[model samples]
Target: MARIAFILLCHKDPKAIIRQAEQLTAVGDYISIHFDARAPKDAYAMIRDALADNSNVTFARKRIRCGWGEWSLVQATLHAVEAAVEAFPRATHFYMVSGDCMAIKSAQYAHAVLDADDVDYIESFDFFESDWIKTGMKEERLIYRHWFNERNQKTLFYRSWWLQRRLGLERSVPADLQVMIGSQWWCLRRRTIEWILDFTRKRRDVMRFFRTTWIPDETFFQTLVRHLVPEPEIRTRTLTFLMFTDYGMPVTFYNDHYDLLLSQDYLFARKISPEAGQLKERLGRLYASDRTDFKISDEGRKLFQFLTGRGRIGRRFAPRFWETETSLGRERELMIIACKKWHVAKRLVGSIKHHTNLTAIDYLFNEEDTPLPDLGGIQTTLEKRTRHRRALMRMLFDYHETDRLIFCIDTANLDLMQDFFSDRSTTRLLEIACEFTDEYLAGHAKRVGLAGEETSDETLKQLLPTIRYDVVFEADRIRDAGFPNHGKIRERNTPEENAARIAEFLSVPEDTARSIAQTPYLFAD
Candidate 1:
């Protein structure tokens, strides 16, 4: 069997780290770990003891006090790689991972893919090519001289370090080296690793140059490997599924992310916190069935095929609705009224009548018993059948010919509806029904209350990254539009306050925005 050496750098989550080490252990494979020196001694001991019995697992003798965005991280990784190579001389490939990362695919699958490929799986891109840097901080990271404090903390020694370049006080990068930036995690062949080690050792100037660089871990190895290897020999994709919030931190995976996780082509996922209920156990169960051969089971193949759109399942479950021509020919703003219950839809229609000047709206219902107003009863076969929420949504987008379609969906259909509109190029908005207090929920019927709670959770997840704005119903805001007081209005931004926000977003008046924000229902009359 071809051997793979894993260099794991960890700071926290000892138990998960041990589990990852144990899971990755194979007959010929070697695991080398380097825990951050700054972490508690007992925590380090716990990790060390857990893997002490495993002969294939080795700990780095020289531990680096790993600091984020510092050279220490790169040094720690170097130490781990050196340890792994020293311990397992026969190792053909090296995989660098963090403690929070867990493999979603089988180890055999990884080995097979790697063995078949000759290219290094490291995502690298030129730093100067695009606006890859975050707002207002690009100059500080690339041009400034950020030094480490006595405690190994990143500190700005001179704020005007860019001026040094003008006066020739700046240290120039090596003429041979090109600045490359990429994801820190990568899988490289042993020869590549050795080349990196040799290059760093020989070029002390290059090492010193990157020492003052911001987040050099992302650039150091990337720059060296890209410079040494041919472009054809480097693959631009990593096998890790990492998501980031607006703040640039990894988004913690939760139970809701199970389908999303499995749908990805990546072999590993990161930042799986303990708060993500049952995810660790679930991943363990997945890895338990992993075989030495990379063959997937029939059921697993079906799922993979479904997610990749290679199967006939989508065609079989295709919606039965057909598109009808709109009378208002080329209207820019098209309001799509999506409701499950007839009563709510009718009330929404009434609200639209009271609020907006529009005489017609497109209404889509899933249930058969739900009545439609008599503009023309062009009932689709799906409207009479059992609820196929997603299918109906797909049909609505496919058939509706409009420039800008504003979907007015109840809380129950928000998630799936968002999924339908995810890939569309046209502009759209999702208005959610939010109840401010328990009193509002109590006032509504049982089903309505349940729907509100479900919508609230889905909206908070912000699953649809495409849609920029979503309207949330405020009790006080609706009260201005003649809605009864269901709960006490809090001091939060009311619908009136949100008028400027909506107007700026949609390019409409703050007063007309009240019609869209206040009218929870927009049923066809």
Candidate 2:
């Protein structure tokens, strides 16, 4: 039921613009274009002639020489809005978009959502009240006059600001208006658009003030709408899916991003590549489809956010094993228990399995008696096993679906200990202390393929704390030997006391810890 009047601000790619106009016209919407005056006249003529047969499309008569961060862009937008208002008489809303934008959702989907309310879809926030400006030109943008193009005339632009600062030539905004800033793309009610147009006609002084303001297109309508409509009637978000680069340019979509585009809940996406024919074709079909419900998968949303650099990049364990990239990002936890004696480490893991909900496994990194028998390919040789120890642990981390896992390794895997400690969200470590004789140390070094490596108690003592760990359980004898604690060392004591310490370290209940300590396997020796 909602009739939308789309005003496209175009500068380049006439063929692509023609195709987009056709798509919008086919969707039962009105189209108006305000081609840049500085762009090639031939390009504008081509677009006009191509869409001449369509009664739904119209071009603005007045075109302004638009420039990035200059007043001309806002002037062109005003001209387009005027043209759209006169052309589409029954338009419920006036939606402004760039020529490079493509429809991500069907027109009916947008109409269904907008027809539910008379609310204005625009992002408007007070400039001084919010950290809206990311380029560090927050207040100065409105306080100074900018005549030079920021994108093409960088030298003159910066020099103008510098000279103005030196001379202390600062301008004041109108006292009646509180300056607002937001995204340029907006879908505003037709009544709201008319009110803005009327205000611009009467308020010549306010128009002049914004004439020299930097990027006034982003601020002019944003500031006016706040004054015309009540705050409750406006939704402070854009319907267009836009992602900007660190340098402040829109990220252009290509052919490979078709699936990504489908996953978006937005109606449209901005700044697509002009030559992306396959992407355009697929999205055009999406617009023509009768699918009503638009829902996005959580996995897809997270991946898209990560792709745009707005979300964290998750760690992948064995990427080759799966068709898509999978990351164990805080989904499951990995706790590695390491000690010199395998028997003692096994006993501790047994106790944990006896009490907690953790999936505990003994000697995961062992050569012959590994808990994971399927790891034969990864642990074929001692050298390869030593080299791929980190990968092995991460594979285990990814393989298990449990909320928490406790696995046992030996001090021989100390070189790769730091890798497990890097992502503290999913990994923790527990080290139990034991005496290593000269023969035992030599055998350990030879077994782990580090025969000639510095393998002594002093070397081991110096290396343990340097590699970060969650907890270290040791008797007072090791403490007297000047082993640097790094606040992770725990004094070995009675089984019940040890359980209490482990319980506190793992943040489990004291009762649970006592139950683990009372296990026959833990206190047998």
Candidate 3:
């Protein structure tokens, strides 16, 4: 009865994302993806393709910098919550995730945690009480003091001891203390959102001050909820669980193995890297009663559909000027950069599928010995799946000559399941999607999207702003933006190595038809 909502944030890494999405999708849940407003259209589109099977995931409209200590990041999150809650009012809890983040447990396990009628799965850090959160607040104050004195950014931190509170990031309720907590990346109830938003509208002053604070998100959310809520329902620990790393990439993971992380009793985490292929199976173990080494059903399929209804996806929301404003980009323009198969991509995809014209899909790695053709199942070969998951993700994200598109996934999906295609939909309508003949989609009667996403909504000009983008990233680089920060670029292989490649990658000539410098969406003069 408790509907699960996964909020997946995308920056780079397509193949890894798809694999993880598929795995997560196997478990039914509401899914939504918040591509960094600045992420390339192609990069965003590739993520869409990965969720083609389901009809709940949709692209978000808010485009703000998701820096570690900026109001812009908090703004993006609040806005994203606004969109998701509007679409899935019935949703019981929302899980904040990153492009690289993955669920070590099955959706069911998580569902149980959230669905447990008695316990409210709210991931909050009562800053007033939390030592870690208090540290962050102290850090904010110290930094602001230094910045104000040296940098003269005094007006920014003028309010109180908690700089984030004064900067408009925190809710100034009861008193003016800024509510601080984990980066708002956690599982929470629908009521919590309603209360927070309402709190914001009422306390405009406190909210306004947070806009200039250092770690707005962490400080703001924690401070507000702790102050407002009675008896503090949040887990005091830092995180509930985690993948190999909070940073999105590809690697191995297991719910049991990561139990220590989960032991924190916290609900959210940041860095994560999991083999795309094993997502469903690995995650399944976390919740489902069924246990096996590798199987898709374990991924959370039944739960996925329960959260994101197919009918919701068919109804199109008015497209923003920006989506149509930019030129249709070149094919394969988004490919050759970023990998996927990380994080449980399904939950995010499911959320988006609900609001878009894009078609949601569940692409299972077809292997022998499974009972059903389109049911949930994980991969028999984890190693090979991981290697190929990335390769195939490139194919999905990269544009081809004919369609000149990365595989276009349609219909906003609540979540995309990767483990195994379900034998059939629980409902009758999902069986017949616009282009798909599958029983589940057909029964749902959801509209499918483009043959594929040829061009992305965002142009090359805007491609940062999701997470601490300025930080040294070991991910891809834009060879040229056709402007000031343009041309002859080299790409960093990993997020950790991103900064080092900046100078070299930016200088590679694009005119040469071919160069180490890869082409982003070619811009119009």
Top-lDDT structure, candidate number: 2
* CA lDDT scores, all candidates in order: 0.59, 0.71, 0.42
Give the per-residue Cα lDDT of candidate 3 at 355. Answer: 31
Residue-wise C-alpha lDDT for candidate 3, range 1-525, written one tens digit per residue: 667667776666777666555555555566666667666878767777767666666556676645445576678777777777877777787767776565544454556556554333434554455564422245444234222321244454454445554664533333546455554555667787788889889988777666655666666666666666664466543333432222333233333324322323333334443543343344434543332222111112221232233224331223334332332333322101111211112322233234323333332232223222221222345333333342333333332222211121211211121100111211111111111123322222221221112212221112112111311121222111112212222222332232223223222223322321122311101
Once superposed on the true structure, which residue ranges of model 2 sit more than 4 Å away at CA?
A: 297-301, 305-350, 353-525
Residue 214 C-alpha lDDT in model 3: 60
lDDT of each residue in 1-525, candidate 1, tens digit only: 446788899888787778878877843467899999988889889998888889889988898787777788888999999899888888888888887776676666667778787879887888777556665455456555556532343243343454565676655567887788788889899899999889889989888888888778878888999988889899987878776655677767776655445445666788677776477677655655555432221122222232233222122333324322112223343344443333544554565456544443334434433443332234444333223443333334345543444444443443333334333233234232332343333223224221222233332233222111211322122334331211221124466754554454345566776665465433212
* Distance from true location, Cα of 423 in model 3, Å: 77
lDDT measured at residue 190 in model 1 versus the true structure, 0 to 100: 88
Winner by TM-score? 2
Question: What lDDT tens digits, residue by residue, belong to model 2 across residues 71-136?
Answer: 888888888889989988988898988888888888888788899877998888888998788756
Q: Which residues of candidate 3, in runs, are more than 4 Å off?
A: 49-53, 117-130, 133-178, 237-239, 242-270, 274-281, 284-525
Listed per candidate, the RMSD to the true structure in angstroms reads 15.3, 18.1, 26.5
Q: Please list the residue runs of candidate 1 whose C-alpha ends up more than 4 Å from where it truly belongs after superposition.
A: 26-28, 149-168, 291-525
Model 2: lowest-lDDT 10 consecutive positions: 482-491
